[model samples]
Target: MMRNLLTLLFPVLCLAQGTNYNFKEAELKARELVFTQPDSALVIIKKTLANSAGAHDTIKGNTYHLYGLYYNMKGMTDSAIYYYKKSLPYIDNYPKIILRPYINISASYRNKGEYETSLKYLNDALTVTKKDNNKTGEAMLYGEMASNYNYMRQYEKSVDLLLKAIAILKTEKKTKQLYAIKQKLANTYLGMENFNFAIDLYKECLPGFKEIGAEKNYYLTYINIGEAYIRLNNLQEAKKALKIAVDGLKKFDDKELIGITYSKIGNIENLERNRESALKNYKKSLDLLLEVKSLWTLRIAGEYIDILNQMGRYSEAQAIINKTAPFQKNTKLNMVDRVVYEKAIAETYSKTNDSKAISAYKNTITLMDSISSAEKEDAVKEIQAKFQTDLQREKNVVLAAKNNALTKAMKAEKKLLYLYIIMSISFIVLILLYLRSYLFKNKLQQEQIKAVESEKALLQQQHLHELELNNAQKEIIEEKERELTSTTLQMANYQDSITQILEKCDLGEITKVSELKKELQHLIKQKDYWRQFETRFNSIHPEFNQKLGNKFSKLTKNDLEFCSLLKLNLSNKEIASLLQISHESAITKKYRIKKKMQITDDDEFEKILSEI
Candidate 1:
């Protein structure tokens, strides 16, 4: 394995030795490939520095970049940053490399958690990256900005930059980097409490990791998916996914990941109320941490200790606290990170009934309070300046939140006002529709009343004419003269009145007085009237079509309006109503027509209807 690794390094070494190229780009790439690669990077950075004192400004700026990498690897980050700054003045010509150098310096500062200074360096890098048109470098700069924002807890800004990085990665088609960006996005989503989106991003990363054989990332994706599901309280899915991951990952794998997986498994089992299984998993995680002797893993140890105490396994939990308590003893922990860690420890100690541990916990809390008070007095101006910016940002957030609420309220009010206007218009439309319908019905009723009255007058006149003819009987000339004198003049007057009524009447509306039996029989006698009657009557039976076709086959004029429309299977009421006839009379006339046409009353109307 050592030989193979060195063999890989041989190609990289040859790449470093190529001196014809004035730029030290290949060396930078080789160093970036392995972040922990200080020793191998030393030769190139040394040569670049040697060239710095010469009259070449471009070589000087490049030397600064190489120097930063060498110091960074040695863990002498401050000294490395100082040298890098010292060399930047000599390299005035190489603006492209100058941009990347600032990024390197900023990354070094970021590792030290000097975020404000880091940001200043990042801005320099950004300006340089833009000047050079280095899209990949700009994307890296964006990723760094996103990382910085996340550390500052400016999650929204972080997410925005991360999205920008993803866009750049997509354009570059950097599949592996895109996968890394996806993980960052997923973490940001987790911070924003958007778990569904977080889970989706994590799922997307799996295929990318598989493509690159990135074992760690593939495992992480599985773990993240399980964790996300666990937070959603989808215990069955969480447990199933996590168990598969736990079984698949080897025990001698990445210790932090293995420990985390154990903790997750323990947590899931605990949620299921499987105490024994939970205890076993927790112990497995504890054993791994102890074996690694990793101070970083001690934070996790603190969490497990708390759970163990709750499980009535006080001795075992206490043993862990005793073993890992030394992690905080020698380390230089940042104030905030220290407080959070101590808080985890204190809660565990308080639960375990460990009096000494509890005293230490309380003392630390008191010490933190005292330090905070002193911080206000001693570091007030600097701290206040930092917090002032944070304060202003918070003020802006509050105002923005208020403005959002106001905007939403305004929109709602506008919607309600529009709704009221629409409702008013709708009410007016409905009222108009009702009024129009009522008017149409009233006009039709008036026309029908006039038609009925005309028919009644016609009937009474016919009856009077008949009575006069019957009463003056059997006297030949004398009786005939009397009949003529009494009835002829009256009959002539009645005929004139009937003609005037017919002339005044709407013949279009009053088609037949099928309203009464006498009215119907009277209509059947007139030649012009039967023509109209046949037009209306032949509409009923199927055989009516056969008779009409035979009779009118040679005739030129046609009226489909009355005949064709009525040929459909209509009931007596429908036919009478349509033809301006009474229902009962229409039925009688239909029977008479049926006898004339030779049609059964119900001979499956539609089957015979096809002939028509």
Candidate 2:
């Protein structure tokens, strides 16, 4: 998608060629004007040339190069080439200066559709850059050459050069250039309709752009991802990525990109049969496109006309067709777009029951048939060519494997012959040595058997000890759980007695109510009872209280008590009776415990406590 925002050709600023006459400041000033004020840029370059006249050819050469760069930015290819050629005579004195002129002139020629000449200049630049061992420069040359090949429709060659450039950029650690080169490679993959590879490359480079805060590139990467998803018929994911791109691009003045993003979203909606949303997004896209007067707006218009006709709004669709008629002839609509326009017009005509509707339908059919025939022919050729290539590659692989086998066989044969010679020489010595070796081997085997038996006995003893230790631990845990259960039952009984005494005191069953109140108060202050219960619970589930406190530092003493009761797996009714509270309060306390621990409904709170 960033292809729509073509890379702006700018001058590459470098230090002055020689120490004779430095004009870096003036060149910087001139370059700043090249894009916004080309006339002023020309003036600055002319002034620099005049002032530096009779100076070293290096100074004059750079001025002439700036002039060429200025004209190239202004789209004056002939004048740019003239100035670029004028600087060539000074290359011997300033070798690096030759690179800029060559590169700029190539780009200029490329803009003029003179790809052959452009490639020649690029090749010359490559030779110079290679001789200088400038990896970054060479990488740039490869990218430029790739772009020229891309224009020539030799996509495979373009992809090859782009890969070479990416390798060089990686070695140079030129991150920005690497991003651009990889993006171009991804776009080439897109042209080949290799959507998955394109998406992978886009995702690979996305983080680099995001890390550097390259907003334009970051959003454009999303747009490209969206386009890939659209091609793969993944409408939901396509809508997501395109919507993100639109939101990010809306913050900037990139209307064209924003419009394209909306158009893609509209296409998704249209495919999903969301007619209302489709119309809304299409109109938004058209409005933005109209502000920029982009040629691509006609394509959106054509699609919009179809949606309108589908909705039975024939007059509205006709109105749009009328408005688009003038632009249709001037704008070079692609075959697919022309097909859409023809179908829309034919559909509108058919709604009116016109005789011309038959002719229009026939024309649309003929165009479709011709396009289908060409596509089928191309597909057949591509398949046949691919099969041949695969066959040849397979043969080469098999032959190479055979050669490798033969080479290995020859080496093995040489080794075998050498071994035979050695064996003959040592035949008598080997017989004497073999008897001595056999006696030593017999002793070694007997020692190894004894060691093996010792190790086996040691492992059995260790396993028996581990089993004993496990049984002992299990018994200890079960004993502690029994102690805890007995203590809980006692506490529950004591609590029930206290409740009965309080109830009798309230009901005047105890005539000495003051004495009964004092006894009930003493029973209620059962600190020692709770302390005993906590000690036994900890012994059963060690670290339960300490871990709950450590994990939830804000948990109060009451919360710890609640967790301890849960650790012992006490029923809520038993806990309520033990605490002398209603069952409802116990449930409320449990809810509070869950909230404090941030436990979810799906999490087993008791299980978590037991693990801790």
Candidate 3:
């Protein structure tokens, strides 16, 4: 009877095992497709979820997690977070499986720019790592936390966390993860403007990325290295790195990174005065940026417009500016990009309307001030000091352990010495006291050295901070000088127009002379614009007149004025219009100034005035 029952149930057992095997296989296939073919992954995940009813909790949880990954790849972050949270409860009992949902949820919050909330989720994941003693999970959590700190502009904290992650990953022989953390550390250094160090670290990561066959990361490192070189003003090296990145990135469908690479190339071209080539690269960048509706579109649009304006294609510049207007309101727009966009607008309007140009320049300055205020240099220095102190404390802890072991050995030796020679007890006691004193003094000296090193590091950081501040202040002053020049030019144009109108009236015998006179008086009484311009110019560029006069004492007041306009890079036509002179007269005036300054080459003439 028992043998007949076993035979009856044999087919049922095999069918159940087969069903479980198929479910597991489907889950693995979906996981592999989540990033490259999210639609297919979604289809697989839906079927898995439907058929996962009454299955093991691990299977159900994995299916839900795969669903979340599908949403994540689709850029539906909120949906991703929801599904990740749903998976958490199902996988709560399984520490290893639960980590995925926690980490995914944290990434979703990070994408939303809720960095604090992201850290909270990471902390939850950290708890899971501790519970399972999962070193890999701990390292991953540290990397994620470092990323959040980097975004928050806490570079010191970011560096410390990334170092911790790298240490663990190195010990675990996690070559892929070790390289990934190193790349992130390089990025943090890049943000801090430590360009050479960043370049070194980026170079170090490249081989590791290649060894792990992370093709995308390998090329991306080239892009970062390019950026660091660009910041360091090594345009030739920058171009070489970017070219390598461009060639490699073409094999992938990541349009945004490719767009960024093209934009960097555009910058290099623009710097070299290859405006046409720059425009071509910028156009490629803009097209891809627009196709992806990337946030970088506004930034590249600003650059494109600046190039168009430089080429005297005002209509094209204005068209691009108008097209990018809606994106200006996006809160996600980087403040640096906002400044660039506003400066572009201001430059565009300076050609036609002074009032609008002034407004836009003011906006640019305001944005710059906001950026300057947000730097928090002192806080960063304090963080650096604290990090150094923590490192010293860790070293001291190791030293103390060594010292305790030595003291135990010495005590044992002392007992042996006492047993061997009771008569030499006094001599041994004196030697032991002397040795203890020497050890204490050595420890003190080591601590003093550590303190000096910490202080030196803080001083170096402070010096870098001061240099940044000086550069920022110089930038603000240069912008002010530009504003003053525009105001002066506008005043010249206004006075010229008034004089022309009065002359015409005198020639034609206008009927409303009294009304016209009253209007003219009202306009003339609206503050002395030229006086304001001079005062501002002197305040911003305090030694401009003195320096130029000292170099060229033969220059007249009018010659100096022309030189100032030239310093601002005004075109001959614009200068002629501002001075209410004929184009030929403007050219003659420039030649006269050049002769007075003893300059023969046109470029040399402009260079002298610019330096002043």
Candidate 4:
């Protein structure tokens, strides 16, 4: 899951110095790199901080804040908390500035599963922001607290906090943040299964996403809208929305998301009783998901198998079951899907008059019984939750009444205090006038100190960035080498296994014809094994296909596969066996591939493929 809506925060740099140290410029550069090149950003921040030993507290604090964001990005929650806390004392005087660290620390704690501790820090930040009347910070803190509540499974509290956040954003006319919060609120309602509310909020947020040109988010919102419509039994609208989502998702090249979009469209078609269309979409979804090895395939497989069984495509359904059996074996498949698969297995066995039909039926019954019990237990928990939510709301109402009374009383007290302040204003002004020169001198000294620190920071930024970039690049290269070594071993093992099969067939050590036929059929079904290898290769060298395509657009898919095998350093015989071809044929194909790329004798094809 994406990190719960912790809006990416960068430190605010307001340096006014014209000196060469340029702390603000260093900060600006780091902020730009932090999201895309975090290690380099950290280098800049550390160098700026080290050179700023005698600088203004604010500069040091901003560096610490950047450090927090860097660690958070890396998912080092404890380190993030440490850095955020280190910046607190320096920035606490600026409520808007100080609240950021508090909220960040809360997010770190929430991510660590310490929800109560996260809430404590969030409440502290909330108080500070409210005292400062900083609406933006208040809304941000509210949003963070809402995420924490959502983590705690306190959905009611999460919704309430989100509403409070939305209210603040709307009142402040913060259109960007307002719509973002609205989206979150809609998702919260989705979690609560309040489809109408979710759809309403999603519709409200859609225009803002478009206005911001957030195509991905807009597509995602359409997805949510489609899901809501599906739940409402509005299949026509669901199809329209999901089709748009799929079209939009294709632009981003996120295979898993594209698969999910297809799966959802399959659901829409299934609901419309368009069996053939549903099967086609589901098969397409399963293919893409299998390519990515997405966990979602388990859920879709259950539906796909059920549909195949209904259509009397028993062999295809059994093939899918066997293909996904490994995932079902090791992973906690959802109970509903597991039962669906079990029932389909029972039906398949019944058609064959197999004894396993009885066992499959029993398994399905037992699994369904367990699901029923779980649902009952969940129902009881829901009741308990409702009771607690009601009590909490009552308490909130009482607290609001008390706050209203306190506001009235404070207003009266403020009026009296103002009268007294007015009477003493002339004397206070005369005292301030006498001390003005002293304060002016101190301000000048502070500016001089800041200028010196800024100059030092400016000098260190570039050198540190270069040093960090080289180190980061070295680490990346070593990591890739290790990955390549592992993949090469797996491919070698697969090739050896294929060679073993061929040798076994050749020797015919008392093998019957029926056994040989079964073995060949099993081998044919084991194409998924090679597909797994291809998936892993793609992950390690994501740019491989794209690079090959760009260079040799006419390269056949088989040729591209040949290039991947070559990159793994497979020998001609091994590649031939894996690709189900003769050694001479593999060599001819390699020549053709090389010729298409115009590679001469001096060119190292393997080395060139490996680089991609």
Measured against the true structure, the TM-scores of the candidates, in listed sequence, are: 0.41, 0.43, 0.52, 0.42
Q: Rate the local accuracy (lDDT) of all candidates.
A: 0.60, 0.74, 0.77, 0.74
lDDT of 2 by residue, 293-403 (tens): 555666788788889888999888777767666655642344455666666776676564444455555545555565566455565455445444544544555456666
Higher-scoring candidate on lDDT, 1 or 2: 2
Per residue, candidate 1 scores C-alpha lDDT tens digits across 148-195 of 776656788998998898899789876566776677678777766788
lDDT of 4 by residue, 289-309 (tens): 777666567778878887887
Error of 2 at 451 (Å): 99
For model 2, the stretches where C-alpha displacement exceeds 4 angstroms are 1-135, 144-154, 170-175, 211-213, 290-293, 330-333, 352-612
For lDDT, the strongest prediction is 3
Highest TM-score, which number?
Answer: 3
TM-score of 2: 0.43
Ranking according to lDDT, highest score first: 3, 4, 2, 1
Q: Can you write out model 3's per-residue Cα lDDT over 199-228, one digit (the tens) per residue?
A: 999999888766644566678889999999
RMSD to the hidden true structure, all candidates: 31.6, 33.1, 38.5, 41.1
| Best first by TM-score, ranked | 3, 2, 4, 1
Model 2: how far residue 73 lies from native, Å: 14
